[model samples]
Structure formats: structure tokens, C-alpha cells
Target: MDYKDYYKVMGVERSATQDEIKRAYRKLARKYHPDVNKEAGSEAKFKELGEAYEVLKDPEKRAAYDQLGSNWRAGQDFQPPPDWGAGFEQRGGMPGNEADFSDFFEALFARSAGGARRAGAGQGGPGAQGMHLRGQDHHAQILIDLEDAYRGATRTLNLRMPEVDAQGHVVTRERTLRVQIPKGVRAGQHIRLAGQGAPGLGEGGAGDLYLEIGFNPHGLYRVEGRDVFIDLPLAPWEAALGAEVNVPTPDGKVALKIPPATGSGRRLRLKGRGIPGATPGDLYVVAQVALPPADTEAARSAYRRLQEDFSSFNPRAALYQGAQS
Candidate 1:
């Protein structure tokens, strides 16, 4: 499929703001309305413009489209990237409106790549007299490990589907299939499994199965884009005396060096060790040095000794700006 330059179609820049894109769309649409222009192909161009704006004016869709990157030139005979839409939120499947676009458009953005195969599906089928309809395509959700997003993995999934019989009675069936979970797939995105949906109507092709992906929340890390954040727990001694602390990451455990006299909330960076493939997103370790709980006599005695050693330290005064307000 030829890549469409949505921005050029709307006369906007790659960084064009939502308002700017919208204004451009409106201006061009008004100028070229076929009802008024009466020019050849004006209607087609106008329809194309509207579709482009519909996707780009909204932040969510625009973001998803942009993440595909500007390396693609409009009108280029292009193939999708090996791992497209990685870290992107996907809109749910909406079947193509045959009345709306060409096959080329359908190929470029087939919201419903797989279709339901139904037997005797029409409102009144000639064979409804004795034929039972095929069941609808089944949808499933798969929650995968975060590492699976960084490095793709395959899973064996068991799917259960319910079908209605001729008399409209519901019966359930289970099917097991092995699915490949592509790396970098984010929440809300789905993988289409061709011919994996329901049985087709009168020998029609089976519908596609869409698999939605979700990341397993890491106990030690929080992910944003490629960057991952972690709260690094530190002993008071480790914070004050400068020590190498063992830190946990999605990849595994590693010794992270902490400079001496580091304060609470201090950030330590581990470059090229975050989510994979994305510049190895940097790991931001926010230090949270902890002291012993003051519930025991031994702990109280230790606190007293530390207070005596640094009695002049006034954390409260510094925190509240000495009651500046």
C-alpha cells in the first residue's frame, strides 16, 4: 500500500498542533467541496481529506500514527515496520464501510482484517428452513510479561466460544491455539489471527481473532514509553557512606554504585538498561533511604545516638522554609 501523508493532505507540519490541523482541514474541505467546486476528483480528494483529519485531529489517533514515524514517505510503495505500533494504544476493530473507500484504503488500514464467517447469516436465508448459522468470531485478551514487550514471546492460549443453535440455544466450545506475541505491543492493541474466528457461512473464510495485549506490572519498576522508573530503597549507611547497592531491573539484578552522602530522593541513572530496543531507556532510580522504625528500645537508643551526633541537623526547618508563609 502507498503510505499516505496525512499532514500533507491537510497542509500541516509534522509538529502541527491539533487546532492547526483542524483549521487546515476545514479550510481545504470548504474550498474543495465537490458540491461547490464541481471539479473532477474534488469529491474524492475531499473525502480523503476528511478521513485524514478525523484521525490526525484527535490526540490519541495522531499519536498512534506519528509513532509509526516520519521515515515513511507519502506515496512510497511501503511495507509496515517489523514491529509497528509498538507502545501504541489501538482503537478497537471497526469493520470497513464498503460504501466508503477503495480496496487500496482497506489494505492500508483494515480495522477488521479478519471477518466473521456466518452460515445463513442474512436476515432471511433461503436455507434458514433447515440451516443453522455459524457462530460469531471470538475475542480474547492476553496479559503478557513486560519482558515479552521488550523481547517478543509466544504463548499457548485456550479460547472458549459460545454459539447459538438453530433454535437460538447457546452452546459453548473451547479451542486451544499457540499465538506469537510480538515485542513492543502495548495495551489496547490487538493481533489479528486470520481464519481463527468462527466458521464461515457457506464456505466463506473464517473471521480473524484479535488479541489485546497488556503488560505485567513489574514490582520494582514503573514504565513510561521506553523509560522505566524505580524507587531505590537504601539503608541510611548506604546513603551516607557511599556504597554499591544491588538494584533490581526488568533484565535482572545488578550492582548500582551510589555516591557517598547521597540524600533521599536523589536520582541515580543506569543508562541503556531500561525497556529494550528504545535506546535502552535510562533507568531512573529515585533514592529512598530508610532508617529503622522507632518502635523498639534498641532502635530508640540508636536514634538517640545519631541525634546526639548530628543534633544541629534541622530537617523540618529546611522542609517548611522556616514557616515562610
Candidate 2:
């Protein structure tokens, strides 16, 4: 997807305040509005303007967009960073028609749009007359360690929440919360904390705070759902014969058996050893042969003797046979 520099689209500077952004968007929008211009591509320009304004006008969305950094240029190929929205707390729902927006807008705010629809459907309109209006639900992404998924953990998190100050400038407020992470909570799963969102109006109850789970980059493991994978480095002798090697997992280290003549890229599975769950995922140990260097005279001599012992074995015989065919 191509990156849309919202500031560039609205002809505003990166350091422009909320008021400056509003004025810039208004001027450009008037020039591009289809009803006024009636020129070719005017509608497209107007839609683009709306999309840009949609993000800039809101303190929450603007704060999130700014986190994407300033190195990106307009129209450049773009993909959001893995932890792009992590630690940001924003109220649910987006105003305006979502269909009129570009994929770039949807990519970032689709979750908020969906939350808006769900909230409206379940709780009725917050503006209904004589109704006790519930507060808006909030959403955020929080990162946890892989070990936390194996065993439940408690974490203290600091979240940045954007709001408009009395001067109409966007400002960020820091909020801290102590949260409990349940075992087997996979990435993309949400943990909901009741009464932690925006305050209610009148006699209604406060809305919920939903935290989406994400795993921190693990040093030794990769996770897929509940499954875990780790590279098991084996010496040349261990690969040629069999050996019992210590493998580190989220739970702890365990001795894994290597079969005779194991090759690099072979995967050995340990059942029910991944994230804790009723139907737990398996841990996969991928074999990687670590060859010893022949820098020393003794090592060179050993390699020469081994090469002579395997002189009849042609490892590339299949490649040569394929070429002939």
C-alpha cells in the first residue's frame, strides 16, 4: 500500500497545531469540493481531502498517525510497523462514512470503525433524548512476553491517550493500569476491563476498555497461535549420529532426542508443550547443522580423513541426474 502523508495532502506542516490543520483542511476542501469546482478529478481530490481531514481533526487519530514517523514520503510504499498502535488508548468509533475513505485510512482505523458500529448497535445512540448515555468504549494494543502466555502474568502498562485541551490543541495524557494476562492468551486476542473507559453521562454506566494482545519479539522462539518454534543447533557429529541435546522452550529447557542421520531443516515435534491450553499447541524444534571450522591443523586433518571415508557418497547425485533429464 502507498503511504498517504496527511499533512502534505492538507498542505500543513508536521508541527501544525490543531487550529492550523483545521484551517488548511478547510481551504483545500473548498477548492476541491466537487459542487464548487466541477473539474475532472475534483471528486477524488475532495475525497482525499476528507480522508486527510478525518485523521487530522481528531486528536486521537492524529496522535496515532504521528507515531508512524516523519521519514516516510507521500506516495511511498508503506506497511505499518508491527507495534504501530501499541500503548495508545483511543475511544471506540469514528465519525463519517467509512466507504468514502481510502485503504490507508481503513488499514489504520478499521478497528475503531467496527467498534463504533458494535457500540451503536448494542448500546443505542449516545445522543438519544432522555436516555442515560453510556461512555464510549476504548481500545488499545498491549505487548506481553511469550513466557506470559505460558504462565499467566500481571503487568503494569503506561498508555498515551490524546485529547483536546481548552486551547483546542492536541495533547497527550498518560494513564497507568495494572492488568492481568491470562495463560494461553494468543496474539490478537482481547482482554476486556470493565468500567475503565470514558465516564458515563447522567446515570449510565462507564464503558469498557479492550486491550488487544501482542507478543514481544522473542530472542529464541517464534510463536504461531499457541505453537512455538525454535532452531536447535547441532554439531556435524551430532547430525551424522544421534545425540540428546538441550532445547530451550518458554516453559524451560528439556533434552530432545535427535534420530540417527538427522539432516538440517528436520522438524521434531513435542506434543502439548507450547502455550498452556486445554488443546495445547506443539513445540517444533528445527534442526540446523553447525559445521566445525577447519582452521586448525588437527581439524583440517580430521576433515580430510572424513572426506576420504565418504568418498563414495555423492551428495549432489540428484542434482546431476536432474540436469541430465
Candidate 3:
């Protein structure tokens, strides 16, 4: 998909404040409005302006858009980076019709709207005058440590909340929250905090805040579902002859026994050692055989002795047979 530079579309600078952006959008919008200018492509130009304004006018969307960086140019081939909108808190619904916006706008903000709808947010639209209506539920993504999923943790998260200031210009206010993360919370799971979202009208109660969980990049392990996987490096001798080695896990280090004749890429399962729960997931230690370098005379001599001992063993025999077949 092509990148649409909203600032360029609205004829504003990247450094333009909310007020400046508003004025620029208004001026361009008036010039491009279909009724005012009957010229060809005027309607398309007007729609483009509206799409740009839709994003630039909202502080939350604008802040998220800016995070995409200033390097992207208009009409350049672009794809959003993974987890681009991970930390920002967004309101429930979008104002305009989805069909009116371009693919670029939809790609960025449409999923948030869909998530809010799926969460049952903004139900029963603002009722009659003076009627008490529930506040809209908010959504955001947060990063946590892999260990935090194994053992519950308390995390402090700073969220950016967008609101119009006294001057009618959008500004972001930082909100810090202390949240409790439950154990066995997998990636993409949400933690709901009641009454933490937008305030209600009149006497209605506040809505909830849904925090989607994600794990920070781990150096030693990779997780899928509740199961965890880790590479266990072993020497050739240790693979050939059974040996016990120390293995690291989320809980702590434990001794793992290697079976004799264990081959590389063989998985050794540790029952119920993964993310803790009623029926816990298993941890798999994948074996990786490490060959010692023959840089020294002693190491070279050892390799020569092993080669002589296993003179009949041809590791490439299968390859030669397959070629002949």
C-alpha cells in the first residue's frame, strides 16, 4: 500500500500544532469542497482532505501517526511496522463513515474501532437530553516480561490520554496507572480494569479499560500459547554420552538430564514447567550439539583420535545414496 502523508495532504508542517493544523485543514477543505468548486477531481480532493483532518484533528490518532516517523514520503510504498500502535490509549468509535476514508486511514485506525465495538463499548448511543449514559470503554496494548506471565506482577504504565484543551486544540495528558497483571496471561489476552475509562454523562458510572498484553523480546526463550521453548547447547561428548546440564527457566535454573545418543534438534519436555496455571503448559528444551574447534594441538589430536575410532562412519552416506537413487 502507498503511504499517505496526512500533513502534506493538509498542507501543514510536521511540527504544526493542533491549532495550526486545524486552520490549514479548514482553508484547504473550503477550497476543495465539491459544492464550492465544481472542477473535476474536486470531490476526491475534498474526501482526501477530510481523511487527513480526521486523523490530524484527533490527538490520539495524530500522536500514533507521528510515531510512524517523518521519513515516509507521500505515495511511497509503505507498510506499518508490527505493533505500531502498542502503547497508546484510544477512544471507542470513529466519527466518520469507514467507506469515506482511504485504505491508509483504515489500516491504522479501523482495527481500534472494531475492537471497541467487539468489546460492547458505546452501546445505546447518547440517549435523550439529560439522560445518563455510560462512558465509552477504552483500549490499549501493554508490554510485559515473560516472567511476569509465569508469576503475577504489578506494573506501572503511563498512558497518553488525548483531550481538547481550553483553546479547543487537541493535547495529550499523561495518565499513570498501577495495574495488576495476572499469572498465565498469554499474549493478546486482555486485562480489564473496571471504571477506568472515560467518565459518564450525569450520574452514569464510568466505563472499563481493556489492556491487551504483549511480551517484551526475550533473549533466551520463545513462547507459543502457554508452551515455552529454549535452546540447550551441548558438547558432542555430552550428546553421545548422557550428561546432566543446567537449564534456565522462567522459574529458575534446573538440572536437565540428556539421554545417551541424543541428536541435535531433539526436544526434551519438562512437564508443567511453562506458564503456571491449573493445567500448566510444558517447556521444551531443544538440543543443539556444539562442536569444539580444533584450534590447539590437544584439540586437534582429540579430533584425529575420534576420526580414527569412527573410521567406518560416513555421515554423508545417505546423501550419496540419495544422489544415486
Best by TM-score: 2
Score candidate 2 by TM-score against the native: 0.84
Predicted candidate 2 versus true structure: per-residue lDDT over 193-297, tens digit per residue? 998877666677787889999999888999999889999999988998999989988888999999989999999999999888889999999999999998999
Query: How do these models rank on lDDT, best leading?
Result: 2, 3, 1
- The residue pairs found clashing in candidate 1 are 115-207, 118-201, 119-201
Q: What is the TM-score of each predicted model, taking all chains together? A: 0.53, 0.84, 0.74
lDDT per residue (tens digit) for residues 145-213 in model 1: 777776788888765444334543333355778989876665557788876655555544555567766
Error of 2 at 251 (Å): 0.8
Distance (Å) between predicted and true CA of 230, model 3?
1.0
Pairs of colliding residues, candidate 2: none
Q: Please list all clashing residue pairs in model 3, or write none if there are none.
A: none
lDDT of each: 0.67, 0.86, 0.85
For residues 19-60, what per-residue lDDT tens digits would candidate 3 score against the true structure? 898899889988989889999999999999988988998888
Point out the worst 10-residue segment of candidate 3 by lDDT. 114-123
Ranking by TM-score: 2, 3, 1
